[model samples]
Target: MNCHQAYEALQGLIDNSLNKKELVEIKTHVRNCPACKAEYRALKMVAEGLDRMPLYETSPGFNKEVFRRLGLEYKPQRRPAWQSLAMAAGLSLSVFWLTALAAALPTLLMGAKAYKLTQWLHHPELILPSFQSAILKSGLAAYQTLGFAAKVAGWLLKSSALPTQMAVAGLLALVLVFITMRFFRPQTSL
Candidate 1:
């Protein structure tokens, strides 16, 4: 019924889809209002211009080209069976050799050290007061290390049992409550 309503209904009017009552109201308003009449004419011109523009057509084989690039119908290429088997065998051999070398290294070093210790004990010239002092210090270190390890182990054992005990007790309580509710609770009629 005003310039504002005519502007809002301009698109619907140009599209020829406005209801009868709305069309009548718009027409009456446009007839009396110059601003609304101009706005309606502008909207109609814009719609007509859009309709007159040329539409573009898509090229043929566009979808097939897209699917081909995406590998939709293509089978995956697999590595040769012998190559896979060789890789697995090489990995296994490397792992086995690594583990065997690790196992042998400590024994070999210990044997070499034992041979040097035996030769030093046999030679009175090489045995000195500093060697005795070093041995004493190493023994003291071992005792201290053992004491610290025992303390850590005792603390871990006490804490580990507590958490498991509490967890089991809580789980048992939950199970008991669930069973009591399932068997003893009354059913309510809907």
Candidate 2:
């Protein structure tokens, strides 16, 4: 590591929190850079001094006394049983809904497909003209397919089941976003 990196990792080095590679790199940098070596020594001394400092125990009544001095009651708050039960029930209900959604998802998707098919069967004009022409003109095929998909999507969005489908899709999207954020988030430590 360079002097700056070595300097930044000094606390990690003192606490033995660095990996083997980083420890080796910082040690090498600190050995060569006189300024960094001095800084490392100072930090190490301070850490050692702190380790050697005596610990004083507080009396059991310390918290009570402080609260009394502040003219406040020293009460440790306790949550009621019903609040815990309500939270657990809410969590259980959420899981149940998600599970039910998972189970019903295929059926809902099939219904959507059926809607498009029915729309085509009833209103033949809504269906795209043969792609055989589109095939002959390769450049137009993608545009034609996109147009057809957009038409079907518009129809689906206008259907009576639109609200339910949107809600399910929204929930799934939120869950995916949350999962991505939770797993890929940056982690830091002292």
Estimate candidate 1's alpha-carbon lDDT, on a 0 to 1 scale. Answer: 0.57
Model 2 RMSD in angstroms: 18.1
Looking at candidate 1, the ten consecutive residues that score lowest on lDDT are 98-107
Per-residue lDDT over 88-127 for candidate 1, one digit per residue giving the tens place of the 0 to 100 score: 6655444433333333333245754643554433333355
Question: How many angstroms is residue 144 displaced in model 2 relative to the true structure, after the best TM-score fit?
Answer: 99
How many steric clashes does model 2 contain?
A: 0
lDDT of 2 by residue, 53-89 (tens): 6656567678889999999989965778886666566
Candidates in order have lDDT scores of 0.57, 0.61
Give the TM-scores of the predictions, in the order they appear: 0.34, 0.31
Which has the greatest TM-score?
1
Error of 2 at 185 (Å): 44
